[model samples]
Target: MKQVPLHRLFMVLLVLLASASCREQSRVPSQAEITAISLKRGQLITCGSSDKKFGTVQFDVSCSPEAQTDFNLALSLLHSFEYDEAEKVFAGIIDENPACAMAYWGVAMANFHPLWTPPSEPELKKGVQALRIAQSIKNKSPREADYVAAIAAFYTDWEQADHYTRCGRFEKAMEALHTTYPADKEATIFYALALNAAAKPTDKQFSKQKMAGQLLAALYPNEPNHPGIIHYTIHTYDYPELAALALPAARKYAAVAPGSAHALHMPSHIFTRLGLWEEDIKSNLASVASAQCYAQEAGLKGHWDEELHGMDYLMYAYLQRGDNDRASAQLAYLQGIKKVEPQNFKVAYAFASIPARYVLENKDWQAAAQLKSRPNFPWKEFPWQQAIIHFTRLLGAVHLGNTAAATAEMQALQANHDDLLRQKDTYKASQVAVQLRASEAWIKLQAGHPQEALVLMTQAADMEDSTEKHPVTPAEVLPARELLGDMLLQLKKPQQALEAYEANLKRHPNRFNGLYGAARAAELAADGTKAAYYYQQLLRVAGAAKSVRAEINAAQNFILAHRSPQS
Candidate 1:
């Protein structure tokens, strides 16, 4: 037979190549589809993949060489809670090598974010689908199958189980996996993460947090660059009692994963816990920029929720330091964002918080009374988060002598608290309860029940002092203990107020209101020396620069009036 013409053969090969390319492209998810799926992954943002080195993770898997390389990258992202990106990478691997069972495992893992909010109905369906696909592939190794089964533990009968219960099941499965493969560093790291995820915010002893910390700290020296190790270490020790221990990890994590917006923001958790305002500011500034960059690259509308989250922290830091202008700019940026992508809990918390915090911290009762939840957002989904607005409004109403408005706002807060209880969010329910008690205390004071007000306020403060604040907040919009001090001052119990303020300062050092309140209380109690010391600290924390806050000026005036005449 005559050989085919060379040009004709080449053209035919080109056509076949084009057909294969079309098939591959069709298999890959479109940008919009990726965005929709990613919204469920908490704070999703695009990041460069040039250096996907998320520390040393050795997950042995049977797949094509190309798929294996991508698998490692995806696994690293999963450990960092970079779920959306990891899911995309894993899906791409499966597209290339359909038999890669672990890639499917990664997709399911991405949807089941143990530490963050529970998966919504859409996310659960997606996760269950991916997990079923992972289970269908029979060529998986015992280890791979075990890994798949561990996630299956979470998805299995999810409708009947609460999020915490499902997470506990997943945690137990991870513990068993760790036992089976004691030498597997991946197993150990994941097990540690599971432990931290299972920790109760109410457990003052921090048993699970410490256990996970011990595991992560053991691996830190060997895997210093590991994003999860460094990130989780900070989280494990984010409490006021344990924050100092996480300083090393907090300092290193940003450098290890400079490209990740979340990595940059995490160090601030420790800083905020320890009241390291300057460091927290730096961390969040970088995070906000990184998040914005990711949004620009993704061509998304407005800022990503990660950016808002960072900006909220940034604003909190600025306000604590009395950098009012900077804080206002952050609020302005937030107001301009007509919408937040994903609109998840992080969005809800930040949106509800930033405005409420601005007015409350400034004691701008008019603004606080007018505080409204961000429109076009799902406030119904987060009743506990929405309570921030009602709580602020109640405070504003009570301060402005609007008892009727205060009572209404207090009722709204109580309803939110009850809603949180019904949802089994005990931590948030407790938080709302504190807000309600404090609001009622103020309302009682306005209604002339001075003794009753003090009792209620003290209970609120004591309740708050019993547990740590959740990581979602930079600090309480208005710490209950500090409010107690304010209530005491209002009741003309200056000495008692001084003691209360000082107590609050010990837990939340250098807060603008804490420092200023203490100074005023000491001044009123005739403790001039203590008053002067707090005023100096206030100046230092609020920065040496001039401030827009009247409280700073009052601090300056008091110090100047009491200054020794010996020039």
Candidate 2:
């Protein structure tokens, strides 16, 4: 009221407003307070409940009290890669509370699917729309705004940026968000996920993946029931050297979220890596059933993509264990499915690889030659997937001594490989290169170019050894090192073949062909003790399985002939 300086009066008013803001911040609701408010609205909010069975994730956001529980549930589903279900839950929250900005963030997150294929054009459009909506909603806190911006990084200029560039941008954004809030568990977990998503498949040292693994491992003890922590822990360590480290998470993830189809299936990644076929089989069987149930509940006309993925694992595990009867059943099941609900890269890989794997693993060359690509799939969009069929045919032709057929199949495969290279998919193109070189080496051997064939095959094996398998594949359709062993065996160099087979077994243990090849190599090398040891191991692994595979019989006869008469 006095004639005070105007600027000083303004500064005093600002201080008073700041003090009032601090008082409001101090009155922010606790979890219990929110729960009581939620209860008053007849909403029972709890983690680990049947309706929210994914895992425990507490993401505090400025939303309606009733929307908080659903937001957490949706975030948990996003962690499990249950994108469709998570989107539905997030949409429900938006419907209940139109100002819930985090629900829109969840919607955008669901559409992106960082660890899977890049979003389709429609999905990208939907995500961009959702992000714009979340940004428009002014009720979100600063942290919520940061979360929205982090995902917005992915949607930014998506049409102009490649998948890798977009992922890198998103990862950089998440890293910045985590750095800004080191105490926020959600930011830390998401940062780890982004790291793994941006990891290069060809990085021999696996720097990014290992770093992500360490981050997740640090979080594991406190968040053992956390779906993202355990799920991402498995993903980050999904390599030959690191897989053993993930065994604990792999063993625990399925039990932690048995309702999630992806969780039920993810443990098999480690089991498959360590050659734990029985456990892989069990994990995938549960996943397949869960996926089937999900498809039914969602009113899908065909099997869910997850079911196809699980069946591929089931086929691989069954073949590894010499359970041909069950393996054939899986093949039949796949052959019957004309379509999958979401025809993504994972589904495409499964569709092409399952049949190819069955023939290659069983060494059914005739069937391989006759292997037809399933109809109704968008094969034109997936040339790398198309390469699978041609590669199978090339191998079959080489085995059957059909040089012309082999040459033709090789040409087709080379075209597919070129297409992949043109598409700038270097990792997959390198895989195709492995297939082409291995097939050409076999063709060289058929033409009596033994030394050239050996050099070429050895190069293929070394190149393949330098990289790790993509998550889409359980293993190479046929490991080139194993092929190197086979070629040496054919050329009457059993010792070198044994060395090759031994090297392959070190990486791909308990594979039926690898084990049988090693035993045969040892037998031909006149190493009876070693041969008996391998044969006995084979029998111990697959003796109970009902199969007429000649390798199994050979192992049985070898074991019987070497038996002690006294025993």
Point to the candidate with the largest TM-score.
2
The TM-score of candidate 1 is: 0.89
lDDT of 1 by residue, 1-567 (tens): 999999999999999999877674334334453334343333334453235345555677987876777787787778777777787778777667766778878888888888778899888978887777677676668998999998899999988888888889988999999999888888888888888778877788999899999888888888877777888888889888898999998888877876677887889998988788989998998888877887787777867888888888888888898888888888888888887677789999999899998999999999999887788777888998899999989889999999889989988888898899888888889989888888888989999999999999999999998887877778888989899999999889999999999999888888999999999999999999999999989988876435768888888898899989994
Best by lDDT: 2
Error of 1 at 121 (Å): 1.2
lDDT of 1: 0.83
Model 2: residues with Cα > 4 Å off, grouped in runs:
1-52, 565-567
Write candidate 2's Cα lDDT for 133-184 as tens digits.
6786766689989999999998999888888888898899999999999989
Span of ten consecutive residues with least summed lDDT in model 1: 35-44
TM-score of each: 0.89, 0.90
